[model samples]
Target: MNPETAKPATAAEHFFDRELSWLEFNDRVLQEALDARTPLVERLKFVAIFSSNLDEFFMVRISGLIERERAGAAGSAPAGMAPSQQLDAIRTHLARQTALQHRLFDGELRELMKQHGILLLDYAALDEPQRGALEAHFSGQVFPVLTPLSVDAGHPFPQMSNLSLNLAVIVEDPVNGLRKFARIKVPDTLPRFVALPQGPDQAGWTGVPLEQLIAGNLARLFPGMIVRGHHMFRITRDADFTVREDEAEDLMLAIEEEVGKRHLDGFVCRLEIERSMPAELRESLMEELEVSSRDVYEFDGLLNLRDLFYFLSLPLPELKDMPWTPVVPAPFQAAPDESGEPRATLFDAIKRGDVLVHHPYHSFAATVQEFITQAAHDPQVLAIKLTLYRTSGDSPIVRALIAAAAARKQVVALIELKARFDEENNIAWANRLEDAGAHVVYGVVGLKTHTKIALVVRKEEEALRRYVHVGTGNYNPKTANLYTDLGLLSCRDDLVADVGDLFNYLTGYSRQDAYRKLLVAPLTLRRRMYELITREMEHARSGAGGHIVAKMNALVDPEMIRHLYEASRAGVRIELVVRGICCLRPGVPGLSENIRVISVVGRYLEHSRIFRFKNGGADEYYIGSADWMTRNLDHRVEAVTPVEDAAAVHHLEQVLAFLLNDNRHAWDLQSDGRYLQRQPAEGEPERAAQALLMEGARLGEF
Candidate 1:
């Protein structure tokens, strides 16, 4: 093991800490909460979103790192930091964020809400009548559902569920004079915030925390015990579990069992307790939970701020952002005839040429949903195939498949059961689809099927034709309104044939090494992407135009980052619009000076992945679900389809340009691993990509 014989440092040395970078992205969300320009209710919703995001981060990312640290695993991540060091840094940063969160909720937000008559009152702050009413409400609505467990020689501490807020009460046995710890889990069935009756002539809402009411009435639960202290706490558990797809006898059962374990048996990753909790009590709970001091957080405000969604959902219009209805792309809407009757169908629109649909701005219901609904009812349609990773709870897409199957049309569905936290929902949908007589596949072994595609085969005239929809997002209409994604509807021979082949590869054992028009992951997507990058590099070297633009949710693959670095050195002007977890360092003096990266975090999530390559002025564009992450590139079964139609290509370019030029709600990544907000310069007009898209959709401009 000579020092000289050590392996050379690779491009990974230039990568940023991915976990830290993700935390930075969450901080940007926090900035949205802190921004006064955001509607007050939306600001609160952002805070809740930030909390929920952090909880998941801890469950998956931090928990994995902690396990590695405990196992004495050696070596640094791509960011070049050891697991223990990353944990330390995470704790420091999270402490700052927690402090800021409490400051916002307890300070400015509280005063503002008070002025609007939305009082977050504590049990002690309630008047006698209000307190009495709450006591009555607790007795009727909460007490029966509560379970109190004692921690002692006779009774070991109860297993705490993940992320459930609980009250740790110290009660003294009156006769024996013995002190004991009791735990009461706040029922998830009950609302986190309980509404109270408005005062005479009152106009706004007032509420009390269910925990505060329960804590105040502990004496009623244990009539003979003397309550001494009560403190609130929550625990986050490890949720990263993978099915052994190769060994699994049933993928569905494995996923179902794993999802169950997520709630009942995950290793504790972090413990959050009230800051005022006694040191001894805190240590006791920590010891019982088997968590380290570094994993503990002391919060002064309400724990589990994700519960703030309760307040965010209030019917206070003035406190929320104005609603804008998603519009159908103008091309999809039929023009009125002389009789004032619309005649065009979604199929007719796609038949004209490839149609590009931008979601949240363009209506998903009118395009994707209509595509499936029409196919289901159309007498000419013979079969329907779709890959569903995650969809809305009440999915119209799934219903359409069920109807098509019931109608004796061949319906094949590849439902991914291991869609992270959406496993249970996906499993339910898969079961229902199976029950409805549809042929359902649980994706491929060892790899998650993440490609968003739907193929409809129809008997048109004298021939069977295929209509394909390839998208950069899931078929979930609910998310379509919250996540910015791109979808292409096309019926071209080659593209539809490729989509048909893709469905075959996903459903049956038809393995094609090369697709006609798709870049299928774990087979051709990664190789094709590398080849494209190399082509751009060659163009740059030959003094031809070498320009590249890619927009994605994340970019963390070591090889891709290195290739981009090489292309930059070869004089390629690379612009990356990454919404989260960008590891590549941009603007380095001589290393990555030609690469520029910007992230836009606005009202809608930028979830689409678009790649553009200017190969000697022959422009090429692609849109799909795969990001540049290693999982997306090398592990998952993904699909990226080329945008061949001139009009569709132009639409993609317009989107990329709008996002790149966005000064509002956009942050630029610096070489120093920091994100600086991109604001309009003096005398420059402000531009927010999402807002502009909304306006464009209103005017039917796209």
Candidate 2:
């Protein structure tokens, strides 16, 4: 284990390929759709999630690998995988997973939907009446949007936008008997699934794929030509682009320009065509798109299952998961005062004790939103400062900040304009905030401000007091109902001071490198994490019994993985609940036998980052906006705070314990990089961590 003796090739054995690990995570998402126990409509949601996830994977990860390959980049991955090698691995893995997804939808889900009186009928399967209705609808609604671009000597090839689904059509001119090729982009503005009128036999809804409707009515567009054949196709472009923040005069303008260019300028990373597509057409597509065979994926059933999300709007409550509303935490819930009025505000509640709110389980509207809304209107509040990584389009948090700014309260918003795919939205938000008189900063020059922390300075009695809310997710209310996240509200002196200092470092040129209580990334997080792991190792070596449990979205940093391995070798029991992209190999005899890794993929996305160290029986817990990824630790600005409140610490401990014991949704990772979904033993009760958490939330457990 000597660092001097270690070779890069040997070190590769201890980790899995980052790209392949991600594909495996997507495969786990596919597994959710494949699981029969999941509700019918919920399964469709998972299929959509899987498709959406793969789209991003191609746009960002696959595109990056292709770029590296084109530049002839050497093996720079910690797993010692060359760019070309990773690309090949992704192609092979993704093809298999995508095929499985298609089969599940086409073979099983469609049939299941039919039984539930919901029909996803093809054009050929439609009855005369249904066809007549669709024809009328298509002529009136869809024909106006259709623009068929021809590929001829005079026309040249059309530029396909990223993730645009289209129909590759072949037509013959009867006069000359010449075959012509044209592409009709399916309008994204229209619904992908065209709903059919309810029939006598079908109690629920019936819908046809929009592409099928377009394909069936091709002759309407080509009046004189004979429609030979038509096949569906989709293209995924390289959406990953970097804005040179250091060189640009205005970071927002640079990002806006980059965002505009990304759609039209990026190279084709993947081409998805229907399996029935002719060889000549496929070859022509490959040639015109400048994509190799490795980049092409042929699908049998559907081009984009992401459109399955459309069916979720159907009013079939029995076919979906039981909806649960998030409850307001007891601390935030209003109580009757002596005069029969509502009791103290959120500020007063936080001042009483640290309040931890878990999203989706804890009402975001009643907690985080209420906090900001109150701050905006609070007469005593002096200033509001926060960082925006990603938020919803109609974000209440942004509006509150704008309100605070309008009220003449000093408002500083560090909006990250480079949050990948969200650049345009973030840019729009930045502009809106700026126009509303809020001071908007585009974050650090070379680093992204990813910390999800907010500071509100208010005059309490006489002195000014700083209250902070640090979280593991964005302040997006829409996602708050979807993603499981944690946020801590406190007026703790040391924590508030650290957050103030962090904001100063972000908004102004404060060369701050240290903090009292919080772990700020790129300066203290990496070093402190290593020290924590080493301390656990020391504890285990001294026979004090060491244990560490951490949960995050991903675990990708090599040094962090190595530290975990070292801790495992030192006899520290390391349990990691990484939801995606785990590079570290666990349970190796000598290297990491003491390490156990599990991933939980279920109803809600596991997004919160929780780190717990036994600390020789004196448990130390932390929750923050960081994963073990290098980007999170050394590249982005992050903050991790100690959960000093005994109640919050206990709640986190319970969460970790539930995840570890979860049988229904947990997937255990083996040393050989394979994951096996856990199941309850005979006579054992079914245990799903998310479901349990929801029940606990309803019962006011935390």
TM-score of each: 0.97, 0.98
Q: Looking at model 2, which ten-residue stretch has the lowest summed lDDT?
A: 1-10
Off by over 4 Å in 2: 1-10, 199-202, 338-340
| C-alpha lDDT of all candidate models, in order | 0.90, 0.91
lDDT of candidate model 2 versus the reference:
0.91
Model 2 TM-score on a 0 to 1 scale: 0.98
Best by lDDT: 2
Error of 1 at 698 (Å): 0.9
Candidate 1, lDDT over the whole model: 0.90
Cα displacement (Å) at residue 621, model 2: 0.4
